[model samples]
Structures are given as structure tokens and as C-alpha cells.
Target: MHSVCVLGLGLIGGSVLRAVRSAGYPAWGATKSEGDRDAALADGYDVEASVEDALRRAADEDALIVLAVPLTALEEVLRQIRALAPSCPLTDVVSVKGPVAEAVGRILPSVRYVGGHPMAGSTESGWAAGSAELFRGAPWVVTAEEETDLTRWAQVARLAIACGAHVIPATPEQHDATVARISHLPHLFAAVLAAVGAEGGPLAWSLAAGSFTDGTRVAGTRPELVRAMCEGNRSALLEALDEALGRLGAARGSLASTGGLAVTVDAGHEARRGFTATPQAGPAEIRIDLKDPNALDELLDLGTLGGRITSIEDDLAVGEELGNP
Candidate 1:
């Protein structure tokens, strides 16, 4: 197993450290947060004295470096990586992929880097709130581009699998566009919904039920973190936001004219049902030979069709197609 070094020991970072360690891989982490550093150290995990120290060790060991920092902190972290471990195999758990990929390309063009985003998180923040099981069974995307190093990509995918996540191979553009709808848009909606409900005053707060709680849960995430995530993918988020507003406008107009929300309510209900419905048949197995010249293309195509890699054995990538036929 390739040793791992994680920079940023909060939430996702902390969880990655814990999960990788549990999987028997040698792992260590560093963070700028003194509280998180102390807490992780007290829990018996190796917490480096500083980012520089962590990077130096990673360089010496030729360990895979995982960037778990927020988008705002990404450039600074990348600069350190460039200085200390310019040639280390690298990956990240950042929420938005395009901007990170772009930054990496500009800053370390020759570095063996793969972008990743684990589609799992909590409304809570910080090291203490994270669990080793947070990513279990979640869809963790690994960006597959034309220039991606297959060996390094496989290493990153293996680590994700060992940490109990199914890997989704996607281009950074595809990942950003898709997540804008499923993830970032939801965060924005949650924020709006929470604010709107709160404006209903004390009576609304008293009558808050499961629907309200569930809908607004992500609105409770730290404001700075939410801002960084939503703002980082500006172009994609704008497109998703525009579509949402168009639907909302139509719904409002219908409600005002017809005094009925049937169209809006029914459409949402059907979409929700479709999302929750299980497949009647088992997923179809998919295999991609890593040595094939078209392997990266095949991986991206599989992800585009909602396939996920369960594991990689030697040169064979074993996956399954879960989307509708």
C-alpha cells in the first residue's frame, strides 16, 4: 500500500486519515487549525507539527498526497506542494473539481495529479464531527482526463476503494456540471428554504417538522465553507440556479393565476420518487483493462452513464452500471 499524507485535518481530511489508517495504510496529516491538530494528536493519530513537515515526509516516502483543504486554501497548499513535493503523486477531496484541476495544471503541469471529490459530508464541521465511515458506500469521483496518469489514477482509486467508497471516473468539466445540480444547487436551495422559514417567525419555528428539517439540514453547514464551495464553481452553479429560478417563476405564476401548485408539486414528487426507486435487476458488471490505450476514455464514458468502479485488481478495473438501461 502506498503511504498517504493528508493536508487539512478537518472533517473530510480527518475522516480520510482515519479511514486510510483503519485500512492498514500508513497515513499522517497536518492542519493549520491548532484545535484540530491537538484533537487529532490526542486521539493517537500522527499529527505533523506543520504543513512543511508533512510535505517533507511525504516527499521522502514518495507517499500519495491528498489535499483536503477548502478551495480558498487550495493555492497556498499547492504552492507548498510545488516547493516540497513537486513530483509526488497527488489527489484531492475538494468539493469542486474544475477550479482545482485548472489550478493544478497551471501550478504543477508536470506533477502526476488526479482530481477527486467524495460525494458525502455532514452539516457539521471540524475534526470531531468526522467519522471513518463517512464515505462508506458513497460515490467518490476521480477525474479522468486525456492527460491523466493511469498508474497514479489507479493508486488514487485504490485508496478510495480501501476507504470504502465506490469510485466514479469523470472529466473535471463533467464532474462540475453534474455536481452543480445535485450538490451545490441543493446547498443554495437549503439556505433559501431555511431563511424563508425563519422569516415565518416563532410560530414557524415551533411547527417545524421533518420536511422542513430535512430540507434545510445542509443550510446549517459553516457559512464560510458553504460560500467557498458554491462560489468556487461559479459558471456551473449559475446555470443550475437559472434553471431552478425559471421553474420557480412558472410555479409562482401558476399559483397566482390558478390558485393551485399541482404542476410544481407533482413534478417534484415524481422526481423524488424516481430518485428513490431501486433497480429491479442487479447492476451489470463492467471491466476495463488498464493497459488498453483507450482505458481513460472507457472510464469516463462509464461514469457518464452512471457506472462506478467497485475495485481494481492488477490491471483490470472492475465496475458496475447502476443507471437505467
Candidate 2:
């Protein structure tokens, strides 16, 4: 991999810089904030004072630029990069992909843009909270559109893997939609819960336990950042919110009508069980408890016809069950 130049030395950007530098890659950073620049220098990182200077140095050194700025600030940076290093392939760590892709398409028509979003980070903000291990074992979604440069996308994926993230490929639309359900809606939900809990004042806080704290943890995130994310993907977020509200409404109706929450609770338990089930390694093996006379033959026929079966055994069955009349 080539050297990396990360823009915006906040938590995500700082973490990227640290991880890349630790992996023996030459890494440089550029931040608009003077205090952040000073802090990066104090941490012994090779950070430039300005984005233009950083891009100039990185271009000369053949480094891949990683845009780690917020979605709202991305267009300006994209335009700057357009003026500075228009030909170089770049990637971003923005939370929303659709908006970034659209901005890149408009500002950087000629440059290769690899849109990425790492499923990691904490409620904390700024470089002080950044860690080299922040991305370890996290899913980093890389958006590849129809006209996407495959080589550039792979380069971004390699960078994510270097930071210990598993690369997940998706289109910008797909990425935005998935994160709407998994990330944006959850943050909104957490915010609502936090607001409700605060209604009870000191007593609510005193009574808060693992469930309350854990569920509302994301509400501690920077308000501006969360607002930007929600606004950037508003359409998808609205869809997710509607679906969640519909489910909740149904659950409420079920509880009121039946005078019991077992149906809703049981369905939730089963869904959660399936969702949290540990993934098994290797090829899936199915065990059929045959009660019909021709069930064994039917299963064998399906597997054999599909050419997916590697082995078969009738020994698991009791002698009486397997015996012919």
C-alpha cells in the first residue's frame, strides 16, 4: 500500500492516521483547526498546517488521500482537492454515502472517489478519543457505483483492511439505506429514550441501570454530527423510522387487545435469537428428522440434483425407522 494522507484530524481521522502509521505506512494529516494541528504535531505525527500543502506533499509522495471530514464540510474539501490534486484517487470516512457520492460527482467529476463508512466509533468526539484499534473487527462499507473505479475501490478496501476492518461492498444507495436502519434510526431512538429518561429528573438518573445506560449511550454523541447524519440521509431515515413506528404500533395494539405482551415479546425474542446467533464456520450441514416414508429419498434427490451435497448418512436413524416393512 502507498502512503496515506488523512484530512480532518478528529476522532475518525486521527484513528485512521494512527492505524496507518502503526502499520508502517507513511501517514500525514491535515486539519483546519489550529488546535487540532498543534495536537497532532504534539503527538509526533507529520501533519501539515493547511489542506493545500498537505495535498501538495501527498501528491508529490504518491499518497492516497482519505477525506475524514463531516458530510456538511465535504463539498468544500472536495472542491479544494479538485483544485489541488484532481487526478489522484481518494476515499472518505463519512457516515453518509449517497450525499458524499453526489458531492464528489459534482465537485470532482474526473477524480476517482471511493466512498466508505466504517461501522465503528464511540459517543466521544475529537482527537483525544481516537484510538488505533477503533476500527478493529468492524465492518467498513465501501460504496461502488456503476461507474466506480474498481481499482480505486480496492485501494480503499485495502486501507480499511490495514486498519483491521472487514471490507463490505455496496452501492451508495444500498449503503445509505442499510445505515438508515442500523445506525441513524438507532441514534434517533436513543435520543428519544434519553429525553424520556430525563423527564423523571434526578430520580430517573438514579434509577438508571445497564439497560437505560446502554440503550441511551449513543445519545451522548455530538448533536451536530448526529443531526448532519440524519439530515444527509433523511429519506432513508424516514423510511426506517416509519417501519420501526409501525412495528411498535402493532405491538402496542397487540398488548392492548389481548391484555398480554407475550405475542410481541415472543416474536422479539425469536428475532433477536436469530439475529444474535453465532455464525457457524464451514459448509452448512442439515439433519432431517424424516417422519414420512419417502422423506429420505426426497431430501437425497434435492441435494443430489443441486450437486451441493458432499455426503449422506442413514446410520443416524434407528434400525426400526430405517428398516423396510
Candidate 3:
């Protein structure tokens, strides 16, 4: 097993570090907060005071370093990692992927960086709130770009699986587009609902129940974190918002007519039924940028990428598809 080290030991990162350590692999956490460092030390876990020191330790151990930080802090973190541990196989748990891949390309061109997003968390946060089971059975998305190193990509996927997550492979762009609708739009809607509920005065507070509280639970997440997430993938989020607004407008029109909202509500229910069970790992996919002349050669060299070539095309000409491996 590759040694594991996590940067920015917040909720997600701390949980990952704990999970990795519990799995019997050596793990270390790098934190800027002295309080957090002391707290981890008291818990009998390895903690580093600086990324430089952490990266140095990772370098010595040839560790897979997970950057579990905010989207805005990614570039600087990548820069620090590149300066200290240039050869480390790096991956991030940031929500957005395209922007992060772009940042990695710019800041750490030589380092191998795989993008990841674990679709797991609660309204809770901080190291104390971290749990080893947070990612258990969760859909852990691993974003592979055209230039992604397959070896490092597999390492990241294995790390996710070791954390008890189901690994799902996707391109950075596809991951962004899908999560925009499923994740980002819902967060916005929750905020909107919470805001409306807050404006309804004491009567609304008294009337609040399971439905209202459940719907608005995510709305209570840290404002700064939400802002960073929304801003990081603003383009995808805006597109998703437009689609959501269109559906809402249709629902409004139905509410005003004799047809009512039964169809709209039913459609949502059926769509949600598909998510009743945990999804299995679909397939291993490797996207090659045809724009590169040597891409075909690289594809031919990828021996164990067991996916069927259901669709063979570029990003501009055709869309990415999921098929058997």
C-alpha cells in the first residue's frame, strides 16, 4: 500500500486520513491550524505543521497525497506540493473538476494529479466531526482527463475503495456537468427554501417539520464554503440553474392549470427511485484527446483498460458515454 497523507484536515480530509490510518496504511495530516495539529496529536495520529514538512515526509515515503481543500486554495496547494514533492502522485477531493484540472495543469505541470469528489458529508464539519465511515458506500467520483496517468489514476481509485467508497470513473467535464445538476442546483434550492422559510416569521418556524427541516438541512452549511463551491464551478452551476428554473416554470404553469403538479411530482419520484440502491462501479474508461497526434499510440499502449469502445470521438464532435468494461 502506498503511504497516505492528507492536506487541509477539515471534515472531508480528516475523515479520509482517519479512514486510511484505520485501514492499516501509514497516514499523516498536514494542517495550518495549531489547534487542529495539537488535537490530532492528542488523538494519537500523525500531524504536520506545514505542507512543506508534510510533502517532505510524503516524498520520503512515496505517498499518495490527497489535497482535500477548498477550490480557491487548490492552485496554491499544488504550487506548494510541486515545489516540495514534485514526484508525489496527487489527487484532490474538491467539488469542481475542470477548474481544478486547469489549475493543476498551470501550477504543477510535471506532477501527476487525479481529480476526485467523494459524494459524502453532513452539515457537520471540522476534525472532531470527521468519521471513518463518512465515505462508506458513497459514490466517490474519480475524474480522469485526457492526459491523466492511468497508473496514478488506478492508485487514486484504490485509495477510494480502501476508504470503502464505490469508485465511478468520469472525465472532468462530464463530472462537472452532472454534479452541477445533481449537487449544485439542489444546494441552491435548499438555500432558497431556507431563506423563504426564515422570512415567514415565528409561524413558519412553529410549522416546520420533517419535510421543511430535511429540505433545508444543507442550507445551514458554511456560507464561505458554499460560496467557494458555487463560484468555482459557476458556469456549470448557472447552466444547471437555468434547466432547474425551466422545470420550475413548467411546474408553476401546471399549478395554474387544471393539469396540476401530479405529473411533475411523479416524474421526480420515479427518477429518485433509481437511486434507492447503491450503484455498482460501471466500467473503466480512458478518454484520449484526439487533438494530440500521439494519442492513438498511447491508447494502444493502455493494455488493461477493459472498457468497450462504445463511442470513439472527441469532446467537440461527440459526447462521453458510459458502457461495459
TM-score of each: 0.94, 0.82, 0.80
Those runs of model 2 whose alpha carbons end farther than 4 Å from true positions after fitting are 201-209, 283-325
Q: For model 2, how does the per-residue alpha-carbon lDDT over 1-325 read when each residue is reduced to its tens digit?
A: 5889999999899999999998889899999988778888998999987999999887788788999988878988988888888877799999988888878888888877788888898877788789999999887776765576555655776778778876566677877888898789989999999999999999999989999999998898889889988989998999999999998898899878887778678987998896676544433444333344554453334322321222123322111111111
How do these models rank on TM-score, best leading?
Answer: 1, 2, 3
How far is 277's C-alpha from truth in model 1 (Å)?
1.3
Error of 1 at 295 (Å): 1.6
Could you tell me how far off, in angstroms, the CA of residue 274 lies in candidate 1 after the best superposition? 1.5
lDDT of 1 by residue, 166-211 (tens): 9999999999999899989999999999999989999999999999
Q: How well does model 2 score by local distance difference test?
A: 0.78
- Write down the lDDT of every candidate, Cα atoms only: 0.93, 0.78, 0.78
Candidate 2 collision pairs: none
